[model samples]
Target: MQFFKQIKSILAVSLVLLFMAAPAIAGQPKYVFYFIGDGLGAAQRQFSEFFLQDQLKNPNSQLVMDTFEVAGINTTYCADTLITDSAAAATALASGVKTNKGVIGKDVNGNNVKTLVEEARDHGMKTGLITTTRLTHATPAAFASHNISRNNENEIADDFLNSGVDFFAGGGIRHFIPASMKIENADALGKTIKSKRKDEKDLVKGFEGKGYSTFIGMKGAKAFKSTDFSKQDKVFAAFTYTHMPYEVERMNQYKNVPSIADMTRAGIDVLAQGDKGFFLMIEGGRIDHAAHANDPSGVIWDTIAFDDAIKTAYEFFQNHKDQTLIVVVGDHETGGMGLGMDSMGYKLNMAALNDVHVSVEDTLNDGAGQYKGDKAAYLSYLSKNFGLSNLSDAEAASLNKAMVSADAGETLGYYKLNPAALTAAHILSTRANINWTTTIHTATMIPMSATGAYAGRFGGYKDNTQIAKAMAQTLGFTL
Candidate 1:
């Protein structure tokens, strides 16, 4: 008996020593928050911070991402090009693989690549996707579906039915219902629902049949409270017929539309019900759209909204510090945004955007609707919406040219945006000392900031794929 007891004691001590010397398996993250700010480059992020501190004069205000413990930069080139589109960049971020532009959750050869969220679901972790763009848009689609082309949004919406995602909230209602189906209050709410799908399949009913707590439009979303989310396991909330309204537009008029932060909070509440863990991806996708339009103030507003979602995650991290990880990065930079124009010398006056009430998209696309070649009316419209009252001779001349072009239904620049709106946005940007190298994406490296559970691994320079590797490793898996 004494000999047996001695052997047992030796084995116990050896096990304790072995665990002490070995890396911690228990430290693996159970909850992960991945925030991708589409088109958020270094300059864009810095301008946002500067706007809050200097322009808004809220010196105490700080971006929640800035409070992260680890900061890093990552190269964003795709397999075929140095400058990547959102589809390819998102594939790399989601699956740690280089893919051609327009590919989602696939490799260069069109092979389906498993993504972090998919892996999380396979491991019995609940998963969610939230975005300001369509739910089937490139960034969100990469994590939940595989496709050869990002343009096949209807097919992507079909994938959502099989994605096994516990929660999803955003736009893309047009991809769900058939065109023959008409929404009751769509006209009153400014919502359209002509399905983009080739078939007459009703995806909203599919979700309902699958036991998802599905809701449509801002009105349905508003009916739920914080406590309501915790009671449901699977949820699908579509807030708009297309992409969600820009943050500026949403705050000004679309008060019913849920912000990115609202979606994040609801996702956390719902996903936390799973016994194992959860993976949630929140994207401020409108930042890219606003940037594509070269709308500086619009970009800042959406970026701030993105940070607000990050703040929501940070609050969750505070409670689950040991088992949670929050990572914020941009898939790619759009607009080639730069602070301080040559005319401004060393001064940058971002506050010029302060008086602006609505986004360029809202001003030109929704508010203005159509132009009638009335230059005075156009000027009045600009003054009413964008607060451009005292136009210099040069500014007036530029506006006059753009106004005529708009009246002729001409689109300006490579992106083919409305001539008048683009002109006004550009002029306002100049006054704010912001400049753009391109209206589209750039090869600029983006920043990554993280806090909690293996965040230190993200501190050094990395390729975009390596970001996926780090997150996968944190979750005790290989990418």
Candidate 2:
């Protein structure tokens, strides 16, 4: 008995000395905010970065990276193909495993899959998904819901409800309303039984079933695209559908809609409420859309909006400091967006055109929807909006000829294959590298940038799936 007591005293003294000499364990970074800009790749980021710096100030300069800019190369391929869509890229980012294009997180075998956000929830972290696109938009949905097909948005909505995420905001009112309230089998929607989003009563009721309490814009007031959020015991997913309106038209259509900055601030406000940390995703979705439309003004403004949102989030992260990790990247580059017309085989003057509208497909293949005075309208719109003050006489005459000729079938726009205006635009695009392909997604890798707790997870060659895995590991969730 005396020997045992002596040994116990010695062990206790040793343990105390060891603990006294040990360094403190750093606090676990309890939060992660993963942002994805769909359809935006390296070109898009380069575009936004330059335009914002050239015109607007650095919106993301709050982070340490803004002072240094830690960038990485990331390949964006889907499970089944080299090219990918939002659904596939998003799934790759949501789940660390690549899946087929058009499929959410499930394999071809149709098995359900867990996403990082889902894992975050399983680990007791509150998860919130926010986007300028629909709440069920592919990227955010990739985190919260998994359906065999991305097209089954209604089922996706149900999945979101079941996921028990604490907060969600965006459009897609069409998905939540019940089929009864919808225009069933309308003439415009021939052969398709369009799902009505009018089932607000039941839809909100469904979230309430999951211990959720809030679903906004039920009565269709103004597309609840506001920044103010409510805090309570239940899950909240709100925001009217109506495509959320384009950036240029949003202020005109919905006076109450929050700016991207406002949305960012509001999301962090609500998502940060959980004591167990939170997983929040906020998307600058329209940057990709505007690029796809080949609209420079739209792209520029939306990029500004996206940047402002990033700035807001970075500020929030700053307040929390090392307790949060932020990962911002594009799923893929859309429109093969590029910069510079130096290689286009001509020194065309874009100073003569503004809203260039010629289609390459039509001009090259006698396709439908010809230019229809594209040169004239584009020049006019450009002069009005773009403020191109350097219209040379020769350039003006050439544009005038193209407009008239296009009316008579000259096919001078990009779609026509002549690519004069595109070439001209390329000149402007390359000055800061803001060129773009036609209005479509291109097969290009996107950009990835990071900061905070796991900022080092980026800064090298990577793939889209690595983004998901990085987020998980950085947050200590480790899939």
Tell me the spans in candidate 2 whose CA falls farther than 4 Å from its real position.
1-26, 56-69, 182-201, 208-238, 251-253, 343-434
- Clash count per candidate: 0, 19
Evaluate all candidate structures by whole-model CA lDDT and list the values in order: 0.86, 0.63
Clashing pairs in 1: none
Once superposed on the true structure, which residue ranges of model 1 sit more than 4 Å away at CA? 1-24, 184-189, 225-227, 365-370
Lowest summed lDDT window (length 10), candidate 1: 184-193
**For residues 1-479, what per-residue lDDT tens digits would candidate 2 score against the true structure?**
99999999999999999977642224546777777877766656655555555443554533222342567878998878787888888888887878888888776677767788888888787778778777777887788778877877777887877777887766665676566654433211111223455344456567766776454443322323432544544345454543444565454334456566666665677767787878888887777765655555456556667767777777878788778777788888777775566544444223223332332221212222233456655665545444433566765665566556555655433334333343334334543334565656667777778877757866688988887777766665554
TM-score of model 1 relative to the true fold? 0.93
TM-score of each: 0.93, 0.74
**Residue-wise C-alpha lDDT for candidate 1, range 1-479, written one tens digit per residue:** 99999999999999999997654466788899999999999988988888878755787777889888899999999999999999999999999999999999999988999999998888789999999999999999999999999999988999999999999999888888875876655621376556677788999999999999877875565764334788887999886778888988888877777889988999999999888889999999999988888888899889999999999899999999999999999999999998887988998886688887777775674455334577788788778778678999999999889888887878877778888888888899999988988889999999999999988987779999999988888786656
